[model samples]
Target chain A: MELYLTKNFGKPNAIAMAGYLKHGGYRALRKVLKKMEPKDVVEEVKDSGLRGRGGAGFPTGLKWSFMPQETDGPKYIACNADESEPGTFKDREFLEKEPQMMIEGLIISAYAMGVNTCYIYIRGEYATQTKILQQALAEAYEKKFLGRNILGSGFDCDIYVHRGAGAYICGEETGLMESIEGKKGQPRKKPPFPANFGLWGRPTTVNNVETFAQVPHIINKGASWFRGIGTEKSTGNTIFGVSGHVNKPGAYELPLGYGLKDLIYKDAGGIRNGRELKAVIPGGSSVKVLPADRIDVPLDHDSLTNAGSSLGTGAVIVMDDTTCMVRVGVVLAHFYRHESCGQCTNCREGSAWLHQLMVGIENGQGKIEDLDLLMDVADSLEGSSICALADAAAWPVQGLVTHFRDEFEEHIKTGKCTSPDSFRI
Target chain B: MLSENAKKEIEREMAKYPEKRAVILAALHLVQKEEGWISQDAMEEVASLLDLTPIEVREVTSFYTMFNMRPVGNHHLQVCTNLSCALMNGRGVVEYIQRKLGIEVGETTGDERFTLSTVECLGSCGTAPMMQIGDDYHENLSEPKIDSILETLK
Candidate 1:
């Protein structure tokens, strides 16, 4: 229904400034700067019930209001373009197609936060995406949308595109700030979150690319209009990046409280090549997995959480019967293990531990008690880390075993795999 | 030693940030582009230019898998072996490329043309079963398609 983000993606020359403006781009930023106060903008977002789309699902406007209103020193806005979550690609597609919309969204958020300098810390693997944004940023600067007085509003701002060195932890707000500060991307402890002391110990606010892209719409169309879409509490549309066995695997902007089954069947064109669905990772790799039997649940933040999973980054990885759940567990565990920044002892050690156990199960060398051991290890890692990386690493392994216990146990008992395996390396 | 152009590029990146160290990633990118890998001398040179210690440069370099501490082939083949890709024949594509190139994972061909690496997710899961050679991504891979892609490469 009423696409906000992906509407402009398929258009020819959507990357060009003229193409973007032709489709009513920057109207929200113009409206926000001309007709609304910063407080009003934040309040509008708050009333809209727009939550952060970057896994955490924190309210966006409330996050903006966290920054000190009257900071004497410089404040910052870090747009986390470091979309490194496995099975997540919605933001990359959004940025690649509608770069201007993301920029406009960030500008509006910057205005709401009174942040003069903003940094889009994108993943380094996105060498091409980085260039596209750089060119768009240059065009915005030339057209006076980014530099000194933007459209003669007497407000000065500059946005910089920072490249992350292939670190997934940089997706975290504090890890991102540290990377920008010229260090390894590691998560900092909370208490003084990015709102109070961030980006060189000043006030800061971090938001996802899609989260900001929705801002212009919230400004242009009233908060109540946005609230009309999606479920109560989880308002507005989210980009569900469906991949793997789906026939049409791409980014679909469905209303938040939409059915997960409908998303796989209708939106993603159902399972590929007429294969029956085996399992699904409703969110990205971090969240729990839902089996084929449990596809009736609504795919939103609250519902997914209630169903014992999460709508993380809205990355729906659909797997048909051809996919082995045990192998899926192994792959995700390996990813988190590789990505764990060596700061927290539990995350650093436990991620590797989880991976080894998964490998054991996959190779048909696992014991029956290892199943309980897997859950126990996952339980231990739930709250043992300084950041959520440990929890993110632990969730998939726990999810696989909980839903597909028979499959995992079958691997252990039969000393063979249920599906064709490829990752012998 | 960094080339004059590399140094100039690093300078431009340094100006964008409030501090010199913030440009380390950008500088590393430039250095890797120029040298194919971040050499010890290159790290030391970058550290000197950015006012950071050489060990600090090494730490950042070794931390991220993108930066090649050792030398690599002329064409680097980074096949994404993560969940999405692995499920959709991503590992098969890697195996195909390895067999075609007459090399194994993390190996360089005798001609120094192709370097095969099975990396983490490259965020191209939408077009799964994919591999990245330099800046371009070769997705929706098959055995015949791998032949055509490799033919275009060398």
Candidate 2:
């Protein structure tokens, strides 16, 4: 099937924009503004089985429905462009190539949620993306696609681009909201999700950049057509950012339930330099690892979950035999340790302890029982925080050590890494 | 109130917010752009400008890694040591800079040209072993690349 979303990548700027316009760019917003009620827009989105692309996989329509429907306070639609998950770079590419699509998505989502002002909280390091998006927003405003009385539909909305200061925790919805509000970006306690008390204690809906980008498509091609692309449970094409030990390592927008083997072998052109695949982090680094035997599993959210993993952000990190599993654990643990917002005790302390222990094992200083201790620490941090940042830190360690306990044991037994000579920690 | 220049820059940011205090962080960013780092006086000034308390300004400043509370060098080197970068020898790149500069993380060089800090992911995983010197991303870095980058900065 032809790729609709990323089809215009690398084309001439005007041609791309024209193509996007032809294939229903801002038509969804126009339709919503002219024909459908805001409530109906929300209902249609809820009917379309679109899920959050920022690792959580929550239903997009359900999330939009959470916003206070009758509130008179200023509401916000925040685009969670802080895609800082370890191996996720799809959103960055999407924004850099077709930023107007993302902007249109944001505007449509904002109008649906009754939000007049919106913010795209981009990662600070995405300098190119920020410039492109900001430029796109300007072009959009000049064309009356963004600012007041958009398209003469009597619906006024403004979208702003906010840059984050390179914090992974900011990828969380509440943290993104806090960061956009010019705060520290630590996650706040729940029971007041962003749908209720967000962006200055008013009602707000934080949706992932890709999730919002899908709105225009869903509206343009009716909800039934959108749902027909992927699977019954996991619908539509997802952009999988394939990296690590792969030949064609780039973002491929494929159907959701595409086979893992087909993704790696056929689409990615198999592993680089003819190396045998050892494991794959199907989602970003936060999800559980799957061994080579599970490569035949479909890459849908439900399938991966049943296979003891998640299709998180669609960042397929392929690992080969040359890689040391202990080193992978150590490297990922170090990230969680550094990125923890330190708002909650378990996450703040547990991530560091897990890192120290993983380092000890990788550096040949671990006892055999340290494996259990690593799991124990990860367990303590999981679900013990205000947001999923802690779990993002904890789950990978738990998965790595659980699936590759033999590698840790081998390291402890040999007092050194057992991988090939080039696999140095 | 903030200075005219600061206010103009902040007004652009405040336009993004429904409430003025929502742009407190942007105000602090503008203050840092002018003053190099956030001083207590600058925080107080920004608080008044955003109609927030000085404590609120201070809390916001201290919370984010990007905002420097005290003085820094003329240039700030933010090396990304997160997972993807680490897989590509990010740790080694950071160590090389520290040894060459003779200043540890969070310290300015003796010449006051650079302040090196290891940060979380910079979201450029494709170009692993990346560093952000100001707004520019120096990605796929090596020892030679690092030497050239530092030399140009100096």
Candidate 3:
């Protein structure tokens, strides 16, 4: 049976909470509050090998350990609910279906990190999601899962919900911190990472909604049991928000090393309408694209990286043969350009330049060198900024050009996208 | 600039926060949602309600793309031309709407009935080539579908 923390989302709210509790809901927080030290909780998570479910996939325990242990200053746990990454909707599904589970997980993470206060920075565009999360939070508070001396352990933590102004950059940890601070959602430089200086310049830990939601499971089930489920490197199951030309395009919570081919063919019901798979963007749009022939590659982090992609955000977006790679490149370029935050010169100008070039190519108004120019601009922008937004803008372009240069050349030479009628640009 | 009901709504939003200035953007969102854009007086009223300076409210309104600084047509159509939608011919739909409405992107129709603008993403890539008007999504758009949509709006 699938050990679902968030996958059993169809049950009624109360029933789901009951089921979660039966499976050990607040037991982790209760244990920590009653017996374990904050550092001990952190050490457990560190030993468990739980990583951030957000795009970066940093070790959650290590992140918690980064906070100053001896400091009396206020520490924070900001849940990054701004699931605005393209092709990534797992957080939304998780929050909407099993909100209590998320709340319980947040409480556990708060206890682990010694955070007395937490914030859920939801995307403003997700008005419905914000409402759901707010209602759940209120319910949690009323049930004594949040606020003031939880379960008589004298561990007090308050959770707040802050909605972002519909900017994708706010999904970034620093940008989310900035938004919580009531500023423009632009990312800050590292070194003063959230562990050292975050949320009002105090030690903070920003974790994705899924990352926190997984804590209860990890805490309830021993670290070894949790570690045994997935590969040694990337432990635990992940919620894959599979979209695009797939027969069954929805959220699938599966083991970490689930075969890409099995997910594409068996689980997702294969390519939609029997269309042959052309490419798959393994982890949202930021990761490099993997060709159909390489579907045998496992879905774990290391395997994906070895196959020239990162298992980013666990968003599997599959493309079929009836799709134009140039057009795809153009679309991603437009997103990066529009959501650049305009903070640094490279991201601001480079995203626009890439978008314009891709638009020219897609519209059949291009020279051959535009392809090379696209790569050059993407190369220049990668790792050249304070934030990864620039690199996020560059990755898809690099993938499209690197893997499908022929498709781009065809568009330039034939002066038209060669894909079938459905994929016409 | 804001009606009594709108002012009350802004106050309700402000009440949700310990710091009134924190909800200024939300109040602005309400004002824009009702009035279709933020006016000078509306910004001033928002500032007064939030105990912030008018300049502060105006800056907040000006910074975000979702907030409109000027009046738009009755139908605010935001087309998603970003990657996934672009793969499914989102630009063609945008061009088709622009030609049919005789207004470029960011321009309102001559009669102020419709306005077109391109956005990054609407988080609904499953139904690619989609546009949002108000809160509703019109997806899987073709040139003919775009024409019918405009006719219905008319």
Candidate 4:
């Protein structure tokens, strides 16, 4: 169980460059600069089978390769620090505790892609995290890890921190590029994917903060070593941010394909207050919810996808027996409704409709016919918008209703929530 | 109007990006920091500084939840009522703050000391039932903790 990401968590001043250097930081950047070529770095990552830590889970090396090697103008690398997905707070840990690790990783990625500039497009709400990153960037620049020829490798690069203004759609690759361009955080239609045309109309590649954080380790430990840690399709360890009804709610750096049951009981100290496990959102709020019976599934990208969910940001949100599924629907639907950027007609109108229906059900005014209506609305939202925001909105509702239809029915039949008010607002 | 220092900060941010339009968010932030909210005049001033139209700046301002188009109290209490926080009784925290401050969500107190809001999520779910006051997150909230935090704030 070699910890790739959280190994330096408890170390003193791990956010500082000196603390990171003491813990063998930037050696990967130096190694890449000295021995390995850009294509070698890219191939090593592809060989490791490392996927994006963001929700999409695309192969990282293949993505880096997509950047045109012979681009005429300035190509860019955007490190997405906009960790806005609900139940997913693992990226915040790296930003606050191990900023240098992620920064070093970003530098290596910039070198691998032959990009001279990288922008860490962080969310606006992360004001404290932003300040820590700024300080860490200053330290990296002073030590010659960033800017000009780094460690005398003839690689010139500069990383900038761009703050996003409170929009979840900005987490979308194209939407992020738009925000970085100082415009509304709206998603553009793809086919002109980011690798071909991105930020400021130049070629760009965006990786999650944790995705880039894994690069330094993969280079230092080699590809086969990383491939040995996690499941076959999903390689290496990831930070799972567990919250809600779990007794010990926090980020746990576990190898991919770890048991969800163990993650809840052993790592997270089981359900809070000796409550029975009712349901779990294995990934973030965007993925499908798993009932208590499905907890035996190994947590990973492929396994979770096969088990009717995806490992989205690896944020596990647990719910105990006392929780109300109707209320859960209301909460999730409300979030999607509020955060939708109002670009596509289906997402803009459909998210509101879904929220309205969920709210009616929660308020004891829903008819049984509304159940089918909810499903129809949720289905329409999937793959119908300019970005995945609509799909993210749809999945949780579908997950809740698909597995916990009885709860929704009970509310409509009895005209009141049957679950205890202890967990409800 | 933007102050001299705000303009300087905006200029520095402008140099970081290839295009000047990209500094609009930073420029808007500077205007809001100095004036408590983004005024029409401030938007116009920022637009002039960044070579964007006032409507362009206004559209960007309205799109984001953080930029205050109108005035706010000295302390902005943004409670996260998203799923994780809701499971941890984030609504209770919002209600408690409402009773204590004598202001509901999206309302400023009569004395203008606190403005209460229920935000979506602030990414502090592990330490849930949290809220952000100014730039700092007040997490793992309880009745007593909320009292102590409010006492210190005023």
Candidate 5:
């Protein structure tokens, strides 16, 4: 229940080494190097039940175990700072404000994984964050915490920042590695995943900025302490990035399995301007949305899944009654269509088709039969691509139509939107 | 086609990676940061510096949206109209900027001082109805805030 990830969020100079060290920043890294063996470090994380914060929710410890214990060449660790998921800005906080915590976590991860070289593949749109992170990296190196013979433990590690050039697809682990290799940021067909063949053909592991940031805490606090906080399955605290149509919207760090309704009504200070809550996208925009009535469900990976949604990135985007579901469909469809890497035909072409269909429906040219057609297209794009992007593109459309069928039908029948305060497309 | 400083920065970046191709994005970023955009000639220069074909460099540039294929105005105003932003009248922000700047979403002002663009999410969703003017984000935007931001830009 104690806050670890964002404890020093608004502290002045928290991004600097002095501020970070004042609050016991690199103590975990020192413990990791001086006391724990590589296997113990990995085992401790495994027992913590920490999942990937980058939306997939894969167990962090399991992911580290996949890296070969002994490698012939250098291994690499890529911290995915490419926080491009719509409605998600949790990782951006770590990158811009508490960067040292994330960097210390990264150094610990490198030590655990036997990685000497690492890269933080950040998105190019984060120009301010990139600068702050660069400064933090320099501070770590200057203090002998980053490069060669760290804390006299004879452990050598170097971290670099590789800025991505405005590609959302590059956030995918393989796409990220490809982007780091200076190639088109497209997800490669995975069989030889990053564990075996990755990053210029060296063994590599990619963890989210938030995921790596959790390691230092787990190492310092122990696994059982982390496990006792949240639900048995979903342990530890995560930053629930609450945005949109809320009275007090921002990132709130709370334990997993937090109530979705409380997140909207209590943590975010309820819906903005006394407007009635209409829908909630509990995860990033890619996850299926839940109607206001269904938000009584808990905010964890499994509970949301049982309710027919995924806890992707913990980005809760709320909508008031004034918002139009059809227009929401249009905007999200446009994002997927613009972001699809065009490698998969279903994703490339289907996302475009979905967007076109949504626009027609929004513009009052849709037919009632088009509703069925939209569902058909969404179904096809779900599992037919090389990556989950096609599924990501499909989920929002599916969630909107499934929950807001009456609205779509109303638009089709009346050739007009019913939402009184719907904005221009 | 690239400045000596940019070339030097790109070389330093190349040294960090095992292969030279890995620095192509950094190299292109360096050129675009200096010249306001990447030209075909500049792509060729970048390709040679990284031991890649001009088409290879061009392929990478064309794939990413951040690289300016053509020139932009002095200030690039990228407004976010994604879901969260849209809920807070993000589209209205775009329309307002369009009216204030006397340009469409993709057009530049005549004096070459400002260019207006409607971008996807830039991850500042907490402060919805926001725009990115170069590196810094103008969050919690309103007509008054936009006016103040524009005045400072000049």
Candidate 6:
């Protein structure tokens, strides 16, 4: 099937405004503005079953309906380009290569949600892609697609690029808003959510770059066609960033319900020299680890959720037999520990303690009972934070220790890492 | 002190936000681009310009990784030592960089030209064993490639 997300990827001048317009770029926005009412647009998306491509998988059209249509003050839309989840780099590819898709998507979405001001919260390290997006934005403004009275529709919307400093938690929607508000990238407690009170305390709708990019497609191609593309629940195509121990490790746009085994073996070129697949982090590092025996799950939200994992950000990090699961545990522990925002006691303390435990086990100072203690710490951290980060921090430890407790037990018993030094190049 | 161009850039970013306080990150980026690493003086200037306290700026500055707390070497070697890269010899690249520069992960060369440090991930995991040197990503690293890259640096 021709990829919806990456259709214009290899085409010349794909990122340029001219090239984008030539291939029917902002045609959806024009159609949405010229023809459909705001509510009708929302209805189309709700029927399409388009979910947020950023981790949570919330329905996009329903999220748009949450905006206060009769509110007096300004409304905002945040495009989450802060793609910092470990094993996920797909947003950068889309942002750099197909800038207009994001612009058009957000413009259409901004109009539908009654938002005149929008922000694209890009990750700090995306210096190159930021420039690419900036050029696209400038071109968008010059062509009267942005600014006052866009295309004589009497609607005005302006998009701004906000660069985030290197903080992983800021990828969380609330945390992202807080960072854009010039504070530490700490996540706010939910209740009065962003839809009601967000971005300087205004009604806001935040969606990922991928989610917004799909809006134009939904509008242009109709919701039914979009629904027909992916699996029933997880509609439409999504990008998967496949990395680690794969031969052709890169981002590939595939339908949502594509099999996990096919993603690893067929799409990513199968474990670098036909090596035996040992395990896989089905989503980003935050999702649970799946043992080699359970690689047949469809790469969609519901199927992966059923398999005790999430299709988060669609980042599939494959591991060959030569890859050490114990070391993988350590690396992820370090990441969570380093990224804990220090607001939540459980995440802040638990992530540190988990890392210490991993370090102790790696250095052969761990007690056998430390295995259970690791699980104990992970258990305590789950559902104990202001955001899902606490849960994210605890997942790898839980998944690895749950699936591979023998490995952790062996390390403590032998007082040494028994896994072969597979990566000591 | 922030330069004229930096101030102009900061002002341009400030106008985009509904709240001027929101431009703090953008202001920090402006300072870092002009001054290599954000200096104590630059923080105060940004805080003052944005109607923020230096402590507020410091709080944000300390929060993020890209905002270097100290002055960086002219060529900052940020290697990805996270899971995906580590599986592909990112650690070896770190070792090679340390051996080549005689500076451990967080140390700078005596010449102050190169600073080698290992970071979590730069999101180039697809092409593993990558390092970001002063905003440019050098991926698929090998011992000889590091040598040639270092040789080309001077």
| TM-score for chain A, candidates 1 onward in order | 0.98, 0.97, 0.97, 0.99, 0.99, 0.98
Q: Residue A261 CA error for candidate 3 (Å)?
A: 1.3
lDDT of 4: 0.92
Residue B38, model 1: Cα distance from true site in angstroms: 0.5
lDDT: worst 10-residue window of model 3 chain B: B10-19
What's model 1's overall lDDT?
A: 0.88
lDDT per residue as tens, model 5, A1-425: 57888889889978788999999988999888889999999999999999999999999999999999898899999999999999999999888788988898899989989999999999999999999989989999999998889999999999999999998899999999999999999999988899999998889999999998888899989999999988988999999999998999999999999999998899899988888999999999999999989999888989999999999999999998988999999999999999999999999999999999999998899999999999999999989988899999999999999999999999999998998777667
lDDT tens readout by residue for model 5, B104-142: 988999999998888888998999889998889999999
Docking quality (DockQ) for each candidate: 0.72, 0.45, 0.37, 0.86, 0.88, 0.73
lDDT of 4 by residue, A1-425 (tens): 77768888868878798899999998999899999999999999999999999988999999999999987799999999999999989999999998998998899999889999999999999999999999999999999999898899899999999999799989999999999999999999998999988998899999999999999999999999999988999999999999999999999999999999999999999999898999999999999999999999998888999999989989999999989998999999989998899999999999999999999998899999999999999999999998899999999999999999988999999999898654665
Best-fitting candidate, scored by DockQ: 5
lDDT of candidate 6 over A1-425, digit per residue (tens) = 96878988868999899889988899999999899998999999999999999999999999999998878889999999998888888998888888999899999998898889999999888888888999999999999999999999999999999999899999998999999999999999998999999999999999999999899989999999998988999999999999988989999999999999998888888988778988999889899999999999999999999999999989998888877667888899999999999999999999999999988887889888888899999999999998999899899999999998888788788887675757742
lDDT of each: 0.88, 0.83, 0.81, 0.92, 0.92, 0.90
| Candidate 4 lDDT tens digits, B34-130 | 8899999998888888888999999999999999989999999899999899999998898898888888789999999899988988899899989
| Candidate 1 RMSD to the real structure | 1.3
For B1-154, candidate 3 gives per-residue lDDT tens digits of 7778877766665544446676766777778878888899988988887777888777767667778888989999999776566666687888888887888999998889998998876666666778988756688788888788878887
Show the lowest summed lDDT stretch of 10 residues, model 4 chain B: B26-35
Give the Cα error of residue A293 in candidate 1, in Å: 0.9
Q: What is the lDDT of residue B115 in candidate 3?
A: 89
Predicted chain A of candidate 2: TM-score: 0.97
Error of 5 at A179 (Å): 0.5
Q: Write the per-residue lDDT of candidate 2 for residues A124-166, one digit (tens) a residue.
A: 6676778778778887887788888888888889888887765
**Candidate 1 off by > 4 Å:** A420-425
